[model samples]
Target: MRRMQKLAVLGALMLSGAAHAQSSVELYGIIDTGVMYVSNVGGHSNWLADPGTAAPNLFGLRGTEDLGGGLKAVFKLEGMFSLNNGASVNGLFGHETYVGLRDDRWGTLTAGNQIDFMFYSLVVDRWGPAFPFVSSLSLRQGSFAGLNIPNGPPGNGSFDFDRTLGAPIPNSVKYLSPTIAGLQVGAQYSFGGQAGSFGQNSGQSFGVNYHIGTVALNGAYTYVKYPELNHGNDGIRNMGAGASWVVGPAELAALYTNTENTENGARVAVYEADVTWTFSPFVHANLAYQFMKGNETLKNQKAHQETLSVMYSLSKRTSIYSGIALQQASGGPAWISLVPGPASGGSQVTGNIGLLHVF
Candidate 1:
């Protein structure tokens, strides 16, 4: 009888210990699609279904396991897909895949494919008032292909040059510091994975953020080496700063970014400002303006763009939105980022209406 009682006590202890260590997993996603009307594309007006205007079509799995002693293990896997034809935008889980350990006092340290500070600081942290409002359509892709960014996507070498669209940095490690007195900092490094060259294709990024009261300030810098450029010695460099203020139901923000291709002496600079206002629990609106300019290597290309957007919430996870943007270019052809093609003229207008659902 004593032996049986000891066995029972051991089993209870095991079960109790198992109960102290807990883990959870969650699946989340967003689906957004709409009809877009472009005034001109390759000299013709067109209408088509577009994705990722209000929000990118993406899904992700996030999990956490308590490790006791104020520590936890966490992981995230995220991917993007096209809603029009149900095709993967990148590879499966190409957007973000990371595993890390978090501690209550030390913040988090993660390793895997990840985004750099450009997106985390400038877009996600500082540009809250302009993000989905100005959307990806207003990001900045012009006729500056003369920059000759080797291996760049077909077109001007400056596609998403500022890296504000969350471009993935593969084989990377990152550290996020715990917020201290309303300030937080982050850094990341990507491995080149070259046989004998450590710097080839390597990249590094750093960001800082501070918030006090209703005002927030952010800044970041990133340098990514491209093996195709200068024998992997030179690459693209980016730096940006932004600030935002909240008052009542309105948010006002401004941002500036500079991008340079060291191999070709190509450079582009952008300035932007925006405002978002909430009229009610279900209604919101935003207005924004942007100016982009390139150096002599790009024929002194310059562009001016303005955007307006409105959203109506049906519930916490569903919303309908509409947006309109106008762009004019001087010294080059006009092209809106995410649009299929460049306009035949120097001016273009685009309007979109879309539905978004989150789960």
Candidate 2:
């Protein structure tokens, strides 16, 4: 009788263990780096360590657990690090660390450090920073005097597609609504977390998207506050919209962003258009043009950027690419180029061959 009781208890424990094992976890990451030459830095031609304008290097743990009914619990912990020096990022998991719940019929609500609604749009314009070769060049000029630039890529910081406030807001909570009739919407808020002020450094953003057939559209707005930068608090208010069309092996996309500094009232606008073509299962090409106009439009202070990227896949997780990036300015400040110059009439050009691997 005692032996039978013990076996019964053991079987019950095994069943419980199996039930708990229904949860799943995954480890994923990407690494990309390259080399290149800069036209003029401090009036001298320079060849330097070009950390390819690809994804930031990172690794992360993400998992989901199925609860009863149609609900599920989800969590993600990811970190950014430098590939050149192998140094762990201070964020530890600051890149994207969050916990939440989801339901197919309902939606998803997550809390922690996360990107804004515009950054997460499913139909995000393809004219973003993730393109090959010229991504770093784009990021270098992504910022203005008082505004912020969206962080680029999943784990890397160099190449992001869209230009927005790049830093993930801390102490944040977000909600994503389920798609209804090809339309999806999301909203997010990040508490300032200040000791006594609710509006000091907080941020709020919302995005709406629509997709039908081979066409998709996106629109987003964000307000980010900066408290410590200047004696008086400052921030950036942004509004953006994008559209894309897909036909056969080619897709065309256009994105426009306008940003205004709260304290200085400086306005900076960027317009981008891109074309992507897939030649085969293993080959692809992308061509793009970007124009940035800043402050008083009357001054003719603007910059133009162009990029061409050609890529070949070696496997599902590995690829090689070569890209050419060029920048020209007519009346913009030196801020428009990687070199130290308002070189009113000069231009910057770069080329690189790089590789990327994911697992």
Candidate 3:
């Protein structure tokens, strides 16, 4: 009887150890805020609290559980909020919420709300340094509302047409493949959830990345069907390619993206280039330029934008930053992304200073 009891106790202890070894979880978040000055917003200059210029205000939980045979169950729940008013930016856990399985030899498969490939390939893998150095105002959104993105924000019908600002796709299933010979690939599909149609309001995305030495190349394509357009058959289509090279303390990158609305024959193309330099362990700078042009459907609207930013790190998790952005538009009023409204004239300028902390 004593021997049997000892065996049972040992077995229980081993089971507990195995279970502990197989699972882990982590919590993380970032908070960023400061003040901003806009030279023109609706024909007036104003100063306001910056919400997410340096980096987005976000919090998240990520966890993984080992399932033996080099596989694991993984999940992430992330959300965004406003630092100025403590308001949820996209609802609770609306930024990203996914559960998936990962295989050591393969990659991962996940389902839920998630970003598409345009952000993953161009913004993240290819020109990753730009995000840390440039402000969110550098993204593209001009006076080209003819694109008429369905369900876009009021008065701004073409917000984030390129989908590089971490826009989420709802009810999506995504697959990412492991890097093979310096190349990796990913794909995603979103179910429209329409009762009688499979393609209504659906979305599809594909992305690929290849890296060798200090150079990386990336490409992505995305198409989303909207019910308000062509009886849910016509939609928005986006495609882009980008490349980046690292040189010691500096990284240089360039990208081109095209967006089109099939419903109304509207199209826009954007060209961008930027360089990021690390001057010291705590100081960094970035300079960037962008040009956007629209087709006849958008009244041939065009915009030219330039941005410069500098940052001083207090530590690995905290920083102080400042930036200025200038924009000039022809064929319509000037509009910068994240600004409250369109410029009354053809030009606009903005400056900002901010603090960032991560945990």
User: By lDDT, who's the top model here?
Assistant: 3
Q: What TM-score would you give candidate 3 relative to the actual structure?
A: 0.93
Q: Where in model 3 is the C-alpha error above 4 Å?
A: 1-19
lDDT of 1 by residue, 1-359 (tens): 12322332343334334443387777899999999999999999999997567778999877777888999877777889998888876676777777778898999988777789999998888866445544667677777776656544665576788888888777788899998999999999987877888888888999999999888899999988887788778988999999999898988998999998899888999999989888988888888898999999887999898988898989989999998888899988788877888899899889999899999
Residue 40 local lDDT, model 2: 50
RMSD of each: 8.4, 8.8, 8.0
- Each model's TM-score, in the order given? 0.91, 0.83, 0.93
Per-model C-alpha lDDT, please?
0.82, 0.64, 0.85
Model 1, TM vs. native? 0.91
Q: Evaluate model 1: give its lDDT.
A: 0.82
How well does model 3 score by local distance difference test? 0.85
**Against the hidden true structure, what lDDT does model 2 obtain?**
0.64
Instruction: Please write out the lDDT profile of model 3 over residues 144-172, one tens digit for every residue.
Output: 88899976678788888898887877778
The candidate maximizing TM-score is: 3
Candidate 2 lDDT by residue in tens digits, 1-359: 12322332343333334445777777899898777666654455666555645556888877777886888877776777778887776456656667778899899988777777545552233333233322444443532433333332332211232334244666678898899998888898977766777777778888888878778888988887776434225676777888878888888888787766666566767888878788887888878798877676225356788878788889989988777777776553333223233222347666777788888
Better of 2 and 3 by lDDT: 3
